[model samples]
Target: MPGIDECLLEVMRLPGARGAAVVDWTSGLALGTIGESPNGDHEATAAETAEVARMAAEQPVFAGDAAVAGPGTRTPGAVPPHPPGLPGLAVEDVIITTAPGYHILRFVETSFDSSVFLHLWLDRAEGNLALARMRLGDIAERLVLA
Candidate 1:
């Protein structure tokens, strides 16, 4: 089990890894980040990745299209009825395409109440998608962010 900093270092050890960030899906915030990219801002990149997770969690289809019980539906621990399946939502990982690279976001289930995720940026030209996915899965299991 490794901490956030060590996890980022391990991700960088993967071949072709450019940059990495740990984001909180619920709040669209970066918990930690490593490396750098020539493509402008890292915080913004992390923020967008968090947004992606938030959007996925909010999709009606994923929640079985049941009408949410309230005006403003909230995620877990927000004083509203729990979003169906969210307590058990199992996202292995997510991959998105960029103009110059591929973004891999791996959700990590931690001991804490909030969900955390790892965001990795890789150069498409140099990255192996399949291998990256496998490695991210392994890393997620090994993560012990207490």
Candidate 2:
């Protein structure tokens, strides 16, 4: 599995990648970063993006039927069935499209609290959204945070 730096390097290899970061949404901290930030400040960008991720992960409005199951199927605060080491959060990824670029937040489901995600900034003209998304998913799965 790749570490934060390795994974981020992989992210930057994508066609339109301008910047990338592994952030902890719960704490609004950037665990690791590479390339240029959208705001010229990776830390601020991470914090801002964390707010967006935190909302999507915690809001019941984004929760699907799995989060609202009847009586004994699940415990309070517990997510639904997920991949082997990932959290089964209601939202997987959040993509925000802007006039010049695309911001993609791919949630990383860790074995711990699952508060981290991979943020990618891609040029709108050069990026292939579908390919970036798919590759991000793969990278997130293989990321190893120590």
Candidate 3:
């Protein structure tokens, strides 16, 4: 398994990859980063992305299995009047695409309840979304936070 720096470097190998970062979504903080940031400020980018990830993860609508979040997950419980019962969820990744680029946020599976993910930004012209998504999945599983 590779650590943050190495995993990020591997992510950059994907075609059209412009920047990458290992972010702790719980705190909107970057553990490690490389290449250019989506907004030129890695800190701001990390914080912005965290909100997206958090919104998705925190919503019970996305829950495949509550157990999937596990014990250490910082996810505060979600509440909505409409749905009487919600199933637990297993979120593989979150992808946001635009005319110029794509941002993929693949959640890292860790031993502890983790709120971390790998953020990869790629240019739409040269990037392959499917391949990038697949590769990011592999990289997420192999990422070793310690």
Instruction: Judging by TM-score against the true structure, name the best candidate.
Output: 2
lDDT score of residue 19 within candidate 3: 96
Worst 10 residues of 2 by lDDT: 78-87
**lDDT agreement of model 2 with the native:** 0.89
RMSD of model 1, in Å? Answer: 6.1
Q: Name the candidate, 1 or 3, with the larger lDDT value.
A: 3
In candidate 3, how many Å is residue 85 off?
22
lDDT of 3: 0.85
lDDT of 3 at 146: 79
Candidate 2: residue 134 lDDT (0-100)? 97
Index of the highest-lDDT prediction = 2
Write model 1 residue lDDT over 12-126, tens digit each, in one string: 9888899988888877777888998435677787778888877765564445223565444546544334343345443556788877788888877655665788888988888
For residues 39-119, what per-residue lDDT tens digits would candidate 3 score against the true structure?
899999999999999888777666653454454553455532222222222567899999899999998877777889899
Candidate 2 lDDT over residue span 92-130, tens digit each: 899999999999999987777678999999999999999
The local distance difference test score of each candidate is: 0.74, 0.89, 0.85
- Model 1 Cα shift for residue 24 (angstroms): 0.9
- Counting clashing residue pairs in each candidate, in order, gives 0, 0, 7
Return the candidate ranking by TM-score, descending.
Answer: 2, 3, 1
lDDT, model 1, position 19? 91
